[model samples]
Target: MNMLDYIDWRGDLTFEQDGFNEVDNLVFSELAYTDMRDIVPEDGSRALTVAQVYGEYKAAGIDQSLMMNDPLPVLEKAAQSPRFKDITVKWYVDKIDTEQHLQFAAVTFIISDKLAYVAFRGTDNTIVGWREDFNISFLSETPGQTEAVAYVNRIAKLTDCKLIVGGHSKGGNFAVYACAFCDKDISEKRVIKIYTNDGPGFMNEVAESENYLSILSKTIKISPDSSPVGLFFLSKAERKVIKSDSKGFMQHNPYKWHVLGAEFESADARTDPFINMTISSWLNTMTDSNKKILVDYIFDSLEASGVTSFNELADNKWNSFNSIFKALTKIDPNDKTDIASSIKKLIASGKDVVISEKQKNAEIKKAEKNKVDNEKQE
Candidate 1:
């Protein structure tokens, strides 16, 4: 059973009867997708129930559909679910600062007693949203992440409940970051769990910090079997892979993930380690300066196509295609390598990484074989 199915079957169970689990975390994470700007409070003083949020959201006639992911159906069901219907929500923060290159939104869910789930909203289909995601590659600290820390710190002051910081996609990255970098007292005492669902990991500098590792014992890193996003940079937290009906990049969608009785169905397989290694090799090989140039080249071209979001770019694929390339020609060649040279380097790097990986695998197998033979002798 997926989230919607889980809601249908277990909707009647309240938090007291059935305490919050990983599945509920995913539910709350998706709840953040709903545009509850005015319907939800920002100061943590006022709050709204899930049912009320859905009512106001529907009454306001907000666009319920985006390019790929749509939360309307799940949200409607959540509003009706006993588990979520009356869940108190507050301190909604949604910001898209183009100047700062940040796209962040988050909300908190009060389940029962003194428990609160701080859910970070995943990336929406905005240009800046996707841009901020790529920006993480070159920049160590993003404006979005900094905001997450502040948001969590402020929210911590308002509530005494144990915080369960969680999110999907880039939001998951923020969840971990916020928990790690928030007030040390909160990170050590207040935070009960940190869930990052298919979220990318931090750079070496951030991931290796004492703060990040301080909460590593509480962090749960989940990914799909063929996950593309979850494998990037990776995390030291105990990682679990879930089965997904969808394949390839499409597995990033939460709905496609398979659910067991209450938990995600475990996968017997993992994605090609080679692909993840290749990506790691490529990024590690590229200088930070080059990464900036590549990112600017791609996004600047897309924006030049007279489109701000992927939805706008896809509405008329033919015209946007021509315009994006036209914008590329206007870029300074001294800043970016020629297409042929860049492609050649990409191919060469992949080959070298693959060969190196194979040699390492062979050595690992030989060592294992040697240990088995020694045991036989004993």
Candidate 2:
């Protein structure tokens, strides 16, 4: 059963009875995607119960066109569940600055009297959000990352409660970043754990920092067997591979993640080596400046289409494509050429890696066969 089923089966049990498990962690992480900015206070001075947020959501109904995934079902489930019904939610903050290509959202869940979970919202379907995500490969910290660290520090100072920070997708990246770089004294004392569920990694500078090393043991990184984002950059923290029902990019969806009882079904290793290698090699080819330029140019082209969200782009496909095509014509010829050449090089690198791996496997087989033949001769 998946998380929804787990919630139904174990809903009645309190934290005291079941204790906080990985299933609960994932449920909270996914719930981070819920848009709670309207219902909860920004300063977090006022506390709203889970039931209240669920009621507000039901009254408002759903808007499927929004960039974020629908959180209504998860809200309803949480409201019904005794485990989460009385949880106090506050400090809801959602920011989307198209000019800066930034999308950052987060909320705090006070699960117990002394325990709180800070969840960072991942990249929504907004073109800006996706652009900010790509910026991570080049920028040391995006605006979202900076805001996340401040948010955590604010919450930590407000309450002495033990903190668990987590997020799914890009949000997961924020969670780790906040924990790694926040005030060392506060984080080292109050932050108990950090969870990154299928989130991308930071650039080498951040990953190799002394701050990251200090909290590496407290961090938990989980990726599906076919993850592309989670395997981005180098991860120095403990990693876990979970089974997913979906394939390719769809596996990145938290709903497709498989769970058995209280925990996710674990995989021995990542299932898609070719994808892993291809992405790694492509990223290796681009310098930080190149990545920054590519991300800016791509997002600028998307914006030129006059579409903010992926939904809008998909709905008006012909117009969006035409607009982007027109915008491409306005770009510097050298930049356009460089972009095309880079893509070709990336594709070639992937092909080369595949061929190299195949050749290495063949050599190993031949060597094994020769050893067996010599043994027979003896």
Which of the numbered candidates is closest to the native, going by highest TM-score? 2
Q: Which ten residues in a row have the lowest lDDT in candidate 1?
A: 338-347
Model 2 over residues 1-378: C-alpha lDDT tens digits? 788888998999998887888788888887777777677879877788888888886677644324344566677898999999889888899999988778999999998878899999998878888889878888888999999999999999887789999999998899999998899887799999899998898889998989888888999998888867788776787889998887655577687789888889998675576465556555766778667666666578779878887666656656765665566567677666556555555435434433443454466579879999999999
TM-score of each: 0.86, 0.87
Residue 130 miss distance in model 2 (angstroms): 0.5
lDDT of every model, 2 decimals: 0.79, 0.79
lDDT of 1 by residue, 159-193 (tens): 88999999999989999999999999999999999
> What RMSD, rounded to one decimal, does every model reach?
13.1, 12.9
Q: Which stretches of candidate 1 lie over 4 Å from their true place?
A: 272-278, 330-335, 338-378
**Which residue pairs does candidate 2 place in steric collision?**
122-171
